[model samples]
Structure formats: structure tokens, C-alpha cells
Target: MAIKYKVLPRKNPRDIAAPEKFYAAAIADGDVDLDRLAELISYQCTVTATDCYAVLHSLEHNIIGELEQGRIVKLGRLGNFQVGISSEGKDTATEVTTTNIVKSRILFRPGKRLRSMLNGLTFKKAG
Candidate 1:
């Protein structure tokens, strides 16, 4: 199946006076929830749906725990996830601390296998 996209017109974000431009944005057909994911895994393996759900639930908890502790989590072929921060600048190096941090974000670096999947992906315009 091809990835679907829609042509959308958007104003220049940097300058409002600038002319609007049309860009191709991805259009998601649907989303698979956690339960559906577990069911799929169960179908592919000998594990029961309930057992698969338990494993997935545990994995979600652990991933969050590792991230909150300032650790980079590597999920095999899926990729690596790490905590990233945006902070206000401080005049002195010593003046900067956790309080200056504006927000923390999760960064993902796709593994080789997952990144390579993009190479063969095809795109189609949304209906």
C-alpha cells in the first residue's frame, strides 16, 4: 500500500506577509490502538492475546521509566529514544540549571532496518 498525502495550503510561518504555498502533507487513514497491536502480535506468535498485552504494557512502562531517568533507550530495530530539552539561556554557565529548562521532548533515531523501509515506500495523493 502507498502512503497517502493531501495538498494543503499554508501561510509562511516565518513571515505572515509572504504568499501562501501548497505543500503535501501525510494523511493518516487510521490508527491502531494498543489492544489491536497486541492482537496482531498474538496472531503472529504462539503467545495468547492476554499475555502479549501484558508484555506490551510492561514494555511501555519500562520505556518511560528509562527516558525519565535521562537514559537513551534502544529498541532493537525500532530505534533509539532519548530525552531532549529546550531551555532559556543563562548569562553564566553556573546560572543555568533544571529550572531554566522550558520543556523536555523525546527524540527518536530510527534504526537501520526501519530507516531503510522508507527507501521503498511509495506515495499516492489522497482521494
Candidate 2:
């Protein structure tokens, strides 16, 4: 199925007074949460919906645990999950410490299969 997108007008960031340009932004048709995902997966495999849900739930839990331990979690064909940090610079290396660490965020890097899927996507203007 072709992805849907809508034209959106955005001003140039470097020059706020510049005329706006229109761009196509993709839109999601809907969301399929964990429960729905389990059912869909069960259809493709022998696992029951409940069992699949349990495994998915556990996977989510374990991924968080791994990330908290300062390790990257790599799920084949899915992606890699890791923690990223933004920090304030110190005048000297000796002055640098955890206090300089401003913020942290979870980052996802899509694996090869996901990247290929993204590259193959076809789009259509939204109705």
C-alpha cells in the first residue's frame, strides 16, 4: 500500500523572514499496539496470541533493562537501542564530571531490513 502524505508549509529555519516552502509529510493511517501486534504475528506463526503477547511483553521489559545497564540492545532486522547524552562542556578535563551531563535520551538505529523497507516505500498525496 502506498504511504499517505499531506503538503505542509514550513518557513526557512536559517532565515525566518524568508517565504515558506511546501513539503510532503507522511501521515500514519493508524496505530497497532502490542495486543493487535500479537494477533497479527500469531497469524503468521504457530504461537498463540496470548503466548506471543507474553513474549513481546518480556522483550520490551528486557530491552529497557539492557539499556539501563549502559549496553546497546540489538534486535536483528529491527534495530539497535541505546542511550544518548547531551552534555555541557567544561573548561578543563578535570572539571568534567557527571554534573556536566545535561540530559539523556533513548536512540534507535534501524537495522538493514528496516532501512531497505524505508528506502522502498511509495507515497501518495493524502485525500
Candidate 3:
């Protein structure tokens, strides 16, 4: 017995680049406000504009706080964010964890789907 296979059409990033161009033009022309732009981007990820902004704001604050503490912060599967230290001396930096010079780092554990996506085994190309 013989089996037949068909190639499925995929939308490459390049294929969708025009939409990005249009979005940029719209924003540059002031056709859409910041809230609308946020909404458009959020829509791509199936999330609400408020939720998207909240996530972005949270990440910004968390990163800033981590850097202020003089410690490396790692968000599992996402990647590590480190703040550079001056060569002057470590003593000048405030420790993230009190009572000890060594600061305790913060780690964000990735959710199940994110973890699986990072592992790169769950996805298969269509044929």
C-alpha cells in the first residue's frame, strides 16, 4: 500500500510583515493611539489590551527592581536578566536580601505550556 502526503500552507513571518508596516504607518500617522496599538498587538496573542499592558508594566517594574538589588534575575525558560556592576567595589551595591552581602536572586517558573514550548518537542511541522 502507498500513502499520499500533502504540504500545508504556512504563513511565514515575511508574509505578515506588511501588516506590521501598515501598523507602524498608522501609528506614525497618528491614525491609532497607544491604547489601540497595544490592543492590536495583544489581539495577535489572544489577550486583552489591559492584560497586555499589565504584563509589560509588570515585567518592566520587576526588571527594574531586580537591577536595583544588584542581583541576577532569571525567569525560567524565558531567559536571565542581569544588571552590570561597577568595578569600584561590591560593597557600594545594596544587597537584595538583607542581613547578608550576597543577594538572593528571584526566579520565575514558566507555566506548563511555556515550558513545553521551550523544550521544543511538542510542535511538529505539518506535511
Candidate 4:
């Protein structure tokens, strides 16, 4: 199956006088929540849906716990996740503290397998 996208007309932010140009934007197929994901995984392996759900839930908790302790959580070929932050610049080294942090986000780096899967994707224009 191929990803579906549609062309959209968007104006340039830097040059408001410029004519709007068409851009391809991917249209989401649908959503698969945790319960649905566990069901799907069960079909592909020996694990039961209940077990898969439990493990996935545990995985989520553990990842957050590790990240809070300032550690990167690596999930093998699935990639790794770590906390990232944006902070205000400080003039002096001692002036910077947690108060300077403006935002915190979780960053995920896709592993080789996931990257290759993305590279192999085919796209179809949405009707």
C-alpha cells in the first residue's frame, strides 16, 4: 500500500507578495490506539493481546522513568528516545538554572530499519 497525499496551495511566509505554490501534504490514513496496536501485534507473534498490552504499558512507564533520571532509552532497532530542551541564553554561567528552560520535549531517533522502511515507502495522490 502507498501513502496518500494531496496538493495544497500555501503562500511563502518570508515573501507575502509571492504567489501561492502547490505543495504535497500527506493525508493521515487513520489512527491505531494502544488497544488496537496490541491486537495487531498479537496476530504477528505468539504473545497474547493481553500480554502485549501489558508489556507496552510497562515500556511506556519505564521510558518516562529513565528519561526523568537523565538517561537515553534505547529500544534496539526501534531507535532511541531522550529528553530535549530549549532554554534562554544567560550572560553568566551561574545565572543559568532550571528557570531558563523554556520547553522540554522527547526526541526519537529512528533506527536503520525504520529509516529504510521510510525510504522504501511509495506515495499516491489522494483523490
Clashes of each: 0, 0, 0, 0
Q: For candidate 2, lDDT tens digit of each residue in 4-123?
A: 999999999999999999999999999998999999999999999999999999999999999999999999889999999999988899998998999999999998888899888899
Maximum-TM-score candidate:
1
Q: Spell out the clash pairs found in candidate 2.
A: none
Q: After superposition, how far is residue 43 of candidate 2 from its true place, in Å?
A: 1.1
- Candidate 4, residues 1-127, lDDT tens digits: the string is 9999999999999999999999999999998887888999999999999999999899999999999999999999999999999999999999999999999999999999999999889999999
lDDT (Cα atoms) of all candidates against the true structure: 0.95, 0.95, 0.57, 0.96
The full ranking of all candidates by TM-score, starting with the best, is 1, 2, 4, 3
RMSD of each: 1.4, 1.8, 15.9, 2.0
- TM-score: the better of candidates 1 and 4: 1
TM-score of every prediction relative to native: 0.91, 0.87, 0.35, 0.85
TM-score of decoy 3: 0.35
The alpha-carbon deviation from the true structure for residue 17 of candidate 1, after best TM-score superposition, in angstroms, is 0.9
Model 1 lDDT, full chain set: 0.95
Q: Pick the candidate with the highest lDDT.
A: 4
Candidate 3 ranges with C-alpha deviation above 4 Å: 1-41, 88-127
Query: Judged by lDDT relative to the true structure, which candidate is superior, 3 or 4?
Result: 4
**Per-residue error at 107 for model 3, in Å?**
16
Write down the RMSD of candidate 4 (Cα, Å).
2.0
